[model samples]
Target: MEDKKRVGIWIRVSTDMQVKDDSPEHHERRARYYVESRDWQVEEVYRLEAVSGKTVMNHPEAQRMLQDLRSGRITGLVFSKLARLARSTKELLEFAEIFRREGADLVSLAEQIDTSTPAGRLFFTIVAAMAEWEREEISSRVAASVPIRAKMGKPLGGQASFGYKWHDKNIVIDEKEAPVRKLMYEIFLDCQRKKTTAERLNDLGHRTRNGSRFSDTTVDRLLRDTTAKGQRLANHTKSVGEGKQWITKPQQEWVIVPCAAIISVELWEKCNAILEEQLSKRARKGRISEYLLAGYVKCTCGTSMYVFSTAKKFTCKNCKNNVKVADMDEIYQQVLKGYLNDIEPKMYVEELEKAIAEKEYLLTTSTKKRAQLRKKMDDLVPLRVSGDLDKEHFAAIYQPIVAQVHQLDKSIPELQAQIDFERIQLNSTDHVLKEAKGLYESWTKMLFPEKRAIIETITEYITVGQDTIDVGILHLSPSSKLTSQHQFMGSWKLPT
Candidate 1:
């Protein structure tokens, strides 16, 4: 009796493929059939489900299979398709060399490439090159489509902006969200400060698209988006490999689609002018301190605090509050322990899951409502075209619907953002706790900048008072470092 050949099967499916029900089982069945047809025994199966073929770094099962192959445990490796093995040509060639060196045969059933023959090996390389070229071609085509869509005032793809909704392949304003955006502009223009504006918005129960409390950065970005002004600007950036690089396209090249402007052009310009002035003022301050707690520390006397020249003390410019840097560090460590201790990781995870589910539900309901509005607006289009509805009446009716759809567009993204944030927090809860402990223990070895960064990451700020030190804990997923650092004073006191 011939010895049954030991073979390993590798199965993987991308996210898109998985959603379509093209599961790993289908790949497994094919591999089993191929191996059994040759009277080979299945040594093991390595399955990667809903995982992208973009990189092997995240696939631990694939790594284990390779390790077994390298150890000469398997005589053959089999997969249903070449692309399933890897999307990159470079990785494919590397895998071929490994199989060749390990004395293992490579089999791709779809392409009918068996690496036991020199002709088959050559054909595998050609197929890998073709697969890679096809992937790049697809990426290029998708990237090129963005500007074209933007020019036509269609949905720019991805998440719809705040106060906008997707309808019949176009982006229209959401009525519910448009009021919120308009309020944001009004509040921002009135306050002329991102931090204060954020605080006021949050006070009014206004959460960002992600369902988190507003931050200065979020407020600033929302104010800066030209889309709120009813204009779609395109070609502001170009693809850079796996990322994008910003390139200021000429004004002439910018595709402007008239949107439902939430704020007037005049209001937008006025707000931006104030922002530019703030930027100029900040630029003039110059980067001077390398103190670990320079910008993060504040004085209870309502003044900015900085690292005193010796780096041993933090001095508040307005209140003459001074505290030893070491005192601040010790207090921070103690506060961190209490803060982390209060958080039950398991409960936190459950809470995050619940929050995510709630947001997802809200998005679904809002999307349905937006769809209804879209239908009404689409129905109006025919009336306008058939002269049954005059342009003014059509505008009066359709404008409100368009505004409502756009509002959902803003709301959906906010809910999605919150869901994404919570999911991330769930994943990192344990790591964050471990790192907090490590940061405290490894403080002595860290440089000033490293120490400052770690403190900034964990705590919102340290405030020095005449007899007390307040260290406010930045929430787990902090949006921005508190601008008015002494706004919330923690109960921690300085060592006498």
Candidate 2:
């Protein structure tokens, strides 16, 4: 046994995977059978039951396999299918690189990929295309079904949120969550008058599930939530161009069972009217003057400079440089055009595509890492419970790990939110590229600011220097201003 070569078997089944009697155990036995038949040591069976093998990001066994490979512990990975290994083609390629670097081979029984054979490599190529196509197909089907589901007032799937409870496969009247729901409606209604309802709620001792005090935006989001009124499930949908929608799909959808309604549809509509009325009032507050080099440009004075929207003019209060509110849009148009003119648009798009891939990777990996850490912490709890250490000693050691876990847990949701937002922005990347091929399209064709708003939201100002320009972004401090993503490139120069 000591002289025998080591092998690891990985299995992943999605939550939706049908089970017959002891299917997982059966898979385990089959994996064992395969490993035992080989002249290899069955070192470990990393079983990821009820997990999605499609994504390495959230898959535990996949992460463990990669770790082992990096450590040069294992030389083999066997899975039932290629899809049981990874979902994204990019991820599959990434796995291939990892395997190739570590002198490991991927063995997919169903796909008959041995990684050592030419035929196996060819199988991999076919699998990659199939995996990509399957992913896109699933996404498109979900997207198309959303509008129909929203129209049907079905419960889109989600956990029983703070104020809801599971009743007969559907979330029903949770009295504890009911008051918060009512408060949300009232807050939405009162926000029109700047009523500070969230502050009031906090004073009244209403906390979120995480025991956090509420802000106005949180209150507003809750008020607009269709789930509170039993009009829709707790799932998300694309709300673009015109109307908002929710989606539901049989068992996949959030159970949209009747719960005691916190507010009526009529009342919800009234709340929306209040939001609209307040929005109009805010609109009357005056134009939002955006700057061209807002995020990536910095000031010479070494202060955090930004385009301050005043009634009279858009001014850099720190540097005291005045940019007329009317001229700001034209300047941004110039800046974007200048970027395209200076750099190749095709090249820039390619760079952006790479960036999107990297960002998505980072996001997914973070989620996976957080889950792994939390799993560790959950496992450790039993040791602590068994009087492994005194309370003080336990606190001294475990507190930081627990805190870090909490931070990661919080981060996952925020990262998911950002991903959701960016997905919306990048949905029309090809269209945006097409638009760029033509002359700079007019801004303000839509009420919402698009590219300029995004740039300004991220940047502070571009700093002019003899050699390079510094792009500053959302800088609150002097040091932060210098270090922002404001790139100083060889081809680019800042405005004097």
- Cα RMSD to native, each candidate? 28.4, 20.6
lDDT of each: 0.70, 0.58
Q: Please give the lDDT score for candidate 2.
A: 0.58
Model 1 weakest lDDT span, ten residues long = 479-488
- lDDT tens string, model 2, 25-141? 444554555555445667767777676555665466667877887787888887666676777766776676567656676766544456533334554566455655665777687
Best by lDDT: 1
lDDT of 1 by residue, 1-496 (tens): 8788799998876775653124465467656765655567999988787777777644788788888887877888888777988887667766765676566788776565655433355555664566557668887888777777777767655766788877887888887777888888899889898999889989998786679998899889888889998876666644442124355766765787777788899999999999999998788656666555667778777687767577577776665667777666666666665665555556655766787688778868886887788789879999999999998988999898888877776555445444543443444454454455455557678777776666765666566767666777765532322222222244544433
Give the TM-score of each candidate. Answer: 0.34, 0.32
Model 1: number of clashes? 17
User: How much is 152 displaced in model 2, in angstroms?
Assistant: 6.3
Candidate 1: segments with Cα more than 4 A from true spot: 1-136, 139-147, 241-247, 284-496
How far residue 486's Cα lies from its native spot in candidate 2, in Å, is 27
